[model samples]
Target chain A: MKMTPKAVVIGSLLVLAAVVFVAVILPYADTNQTVPSEIFRSRVSEEAAGRLIYIQNGCVYCHSQSIRKVDWGLGADRIAQAGDYVEDHPILLGSARTGPDLSQAGGEHPDDWHIAHFINPRYTRPVSIMPAFEFLGMDRVATLTSYVQSLGLKAADRRMERQRFWKQEAIKAYEAGPEANVRWLNENVPQGWRDVPNPYPTTEAGLARGHVIYQNFCLGCHGPVGDGMGPAQPWIYPPPLNFTILKGREVSGGVLYYQIMNGITGTAMPYFKRELESQKIWEVGDYVAVYFINQSDANSEPRGIDAAWEP
Target chain B: MSNPSPTYQTAKGFCLTSAFWMIVGTLMGLIGATELVAPDLTKNIGWLVFGRVRPIHINIVLFGFVTPGLLAAAFYYFPRLLKTELYSERLGVVTVVAWNIALVAVVLTLMLGYTQGREYAELIWPIDVAVIVVFLMVFFNFIMTVKQRTEPVLYVSVWYALAAVILTACTYALGNIVWRPSSGALVGIPDAIILWFYGHNVFGLLLTPLSAGVTYYVIPRSVRAPLYSHTLSLLGFWSLIVVYTHIGTHHLLQVPVPTWLKVIAIVDSVAMVIPVMAFLINIWYTAKGRLGEIHADIGAKFVFTGTIMYFFVSIQGSMMSLPDVQRVTHFNNWVVAHAHIGVLGFAGMIALGGLYYILPKVTGRPLYSRLLADIQYWLVLIVSIGFTVVLTIAGLIQGNGWLNGETVYRILPQIHPYYVTRASLGLILVIGAALGFYNIVRTLFVRSGEAVT
Candidate 1:
């Protein structure tokens, strides 16, 4: 009848054992029943080979591979499933998160981007703490890039397919000169967005705010002069845009806003819509219009009937 | 047999010094928190930039302030429990002085931006060497002390304390790449692995063990009872070593590392609960009916609360390590939350406990004021809890925004208010830290003595 310490400890251990058996051990054993999506598949042999280097070097320390419903806001696509880890035994679900997650990282960028990033995160990200893998050498860096590219399994394959398809078009467009390439880029934007006018107008205050925003967010690629000659330009193909060329051209405000806000995908111009606000986007667009293009339509429009702010 | 002396005089100096550091560290932490919110709270003075001040705050609060403070307690008690004099109080003091020097170097390097640019490993290489040197000195002193112990039975607390010192001596060297100071790396990808392997272990091995060692030592003594199960204590200790060592690879799961290694990391991270909970259950049970005993002793109160914080931190740490859990926690302030919880909540609390536990006995004068100590205890508890809530909410918002492709700009407005709240809570901790430091320093050197009440 006595509640001895020994008895209490033993009983608690039993409960813990039961909990682990159900929560951890059971799921691990039932790997077969793991739900596989259309995106699920095994890693290619090359990717598998690259994984060895990943483990030996400790890449997982800074990155993670899984994305969840909550992660949809992080620009994530799909949630991870048990089937995605079917081949995994120990599972590299990291604890001490010193860096970003990598679970669903497939075809997010081209192979070259990985190389430059792996060589030194700062080269691409400017302020990254991900550490330089330059010592991994070009050959190993290439191998590491391959492994990182295979993170999403079949999902990565689709992205890779898209990249391959667009790469040919992009290369051909570039070969034809900047005029053809700019046309090719603009042509890709959906028709509606291309014709739309920038709703926000250019104001002095707006232009100043845009200048600050551009320095913090876009200066890494879009040069200080509004030309695409930022530090990361050489590393990126089709480089950053030369905004001056759009001067006096009939490029709609909507087109410029779309490119600035959404970023030209498959290029180094990452979408600033996530890091910047709508006001910031409008301000920066006005800045480019005034400084680079020598034009200002930002505040010029009384076009749309004021619904709420007309007072 | 000669009566075992209860005065515990030899460690009196350490008790005084540790208390002083706790107060100083907390003050720095408060200032650091203020800077986080207003940023220009100090008008952008070079000394107060978040970049410079944050590292100093962390180091002074951690190494300069907390770790040494805890080690002092460990030094005093481990020898007594084993029925031995510290192998050399002389060596102990030497370690303390050397540790202070390293901390000074940390503040200077951070201020000068002579940083290695890693989070915990921010101290440049030379100071890193000083840390290793201090560890070696402490290790030598403790191991010698244990070897000469008069007690026939080695308590679990001693085992943990010894393991913590020895492992830190090794892991710190490996993690910092102390050998190659020029670059402090092995080229590319391997360097990242090595650095993080050391980084997480700083928490898992060094801080965890030392904190647990102090807890084990203080629990039974404060409760006036023998440990519930010495066997379970040892099981927890050894299993911690087994599971914690290989889990470093979990940090790299998103990289192009080998799948097998990542598998090892994830499994072990989950497996970590076994050892973690083992220690928690054993300690919690040891003090089950001793709530009054714990509350009666300010030191025990800190340790008891620390044990609870450990429960939250370890569980959170385990969950964050999971791929599913990490999807929402990674690269955000969530990890920062874990860091503070582990460093400040769990380790920092125990460090204060260690100081208070030894203060009365060492000074032979009741704490300059038990009332002040109790006040400090509440201030710290409130501030720490506030930090956990605010930082966690901010992390969730940032993580969710990124996942939804909500754009970084859009997320800033959502979390700005949380940052302001965190800064305000930080001010509370800062005030508490200042009060604690003043009380401790006054206790150590002031002549005025209040009647023991």
Candidate 2:
């Protein structure tokens, strides 16, 4: 090899050609061989339009679409298969998770919830640091919501169906009266959960901690006053729980914890089990009981577990 | 053989332009880092949003700071090594002017949200054409210069420089999908395959080779010695071109691109160690026992540090391509840290080194302030290392958190401090870039009326 310029250029081109052939051309030619997964389907035109909006907004920077086996512990119901992304152009298996994985985000919330959240994440999650997409406008927000609601494809559609089903029941209970809605909401809690009271005692420090957690995770929809009158209330149906109504009801700390941790399926109340630790959940439940409900069963009998730092 | 009045105006122009853009590019990076710490920091500001600013920072760094700096040295050495004046200094200067104009267009269009929306291939069709034109012009200038050379056997530096320009011209065209001006893409997985092929090569083929060329020329000259092994250097060069090209698919290992393609990408990624070690062995052997000489010359010091960074980044790159390793590291800040090491730590350092090494020769004057150059060097080295540490820790925490089934919001409070630390470190790099720009500008245009060595 005398290292001539002509030789260098020709050799470099050949190397590049080989790579393009193997890595690019070969795969491109075989794209039709990529069979759609069980969950995969062609995007509806609206969803496809929303996908473009998602790309334009660079939402992929903060959210990942693909879930792996490692994500199983992260509440992932299914691991991503390559066939799932057969229809995705630039497959947004995004690089960062500044926000939660949206692989199963379809039907995670109703359109109204997404609209409010897009307007400002703080409206739904007080502590959320996600940038607001209000500038995308209401129409674009609807488009974006559609795309997000289609994240898990067929699986997402099934989830959305459940949400729609519950949405109707919740609206029916809500329109009847506050007493009826409160009774309806508490009826969904199991008797074991309804009977259990808060195990942890209320303290100023505990309340303060609860206050902080509430602001970051719950204040957006629950409102600062625990009245379910947060900014997102306008968009969320069954309009978050107005905790004052539960003051005289049989709403125990355990019931609050169960609902917050497991999330009310088919409603806008998303599960906080992944976002908040157990202690934070207990504390927020106690805060809700003491402040909004005007009752504290925090020191009731049959305490499940004693705090190590308890006096 | 030195002429009484040898003016490298084209090289000087590019050197100045690269320094100026380095400041702008790093500032954009700093803004993006700050936004990460506080997403609402630039709320309602469309142009300054993370999405838009990220591409601007990346495009500017690639085109504005690193490439021009490498080309500046290439222009200077190509003529000297070939025993000829540049085929056309006027054409070279025109290319420099056109290069800066295209860069300005890249920033404006991307900021205004007129992008093709592919990573590394974000430039719209018009700007893509502009980019291809400038690269073609540079290639024409260099190839014509080679034709006019009195020397017969082409040195390794000439070969590397010529290869970089021509190869990039083709890569940019194919990657950007210039043929399809509307979407700039093929539909589905095919587009991702082509886009990444162009993406990784932009670094592997362009920056790697150009930086290597500058290193081969500057290291030996600074120490007043010949290269340790010409055979090893050529081996490294050819091996790099062969191995580096196939490794782009390593990025898609988790994707559904083909199993065979993934195998090739992973295999070739590990195989990169051969060429990487070959280059390192050759350069380190050449600089053996010459640490004092390298340290004395700030340019050689930067280049030397770059070679060390190259070893770390290349090895890390190989390990990250594995399916098991990627399970923990992929789609996270671990890759971000790796990218910083490759682009900023390795390539950016060498680009700066190339500029500094040729400053005196091109200007016919010693640096305006060697102390300032030293400060900038330490600042860049420390901040880049700081970025690697902070981002890697953040990545690990996120990876483990996600593995533990912790929600993304839960990880936010934990990683907030790291983002803050990264932003603070980014400020240091911005300062370093500003200082380097000042030093280069003063060195070129400001005369101290002092004699050189």
Query: Highest lDDT: which candidate?
Result: 2
| Poorest lDDT segment (10 consecutive residues) of candidate 2 chain B | B444-453
Off by over 4 Å in 1: A1-311, B1-13, B23-35, B39-49, B448-453
Interface RMSD of structure candidate 2 (Å): 2.1
> Each predicted complex: what DockQ?
0.08, 0.56
Model 1: lDDT of residue B229:
81
Residue A88: error of model 1 in Å?
28
User: What would the per-residue lDDT of candidate 1 be over residues A58-160, giving only the tens digit for each residue?
Assistant: 4543455555455433326576654566564224444332345566666766776676676555455553444455655788778878887888777787877
Interface root-mean-square deviation (Å) of every model:
11.6, 2.1
Cα lDDT tens digits, model 2, A1-311, are 78777788888888778777777777888875677889988889999888888877667767777676667433287877768877676567666777777888888777788888888887887657777787778898899899989988998899899888888998888899988987888899888888888888899999999888887888888888999898899888778888887877788888899999989766678887767878899999998888888997886888656658777
* RMSD (CA, Å), each prediction: 9.7, 2.5
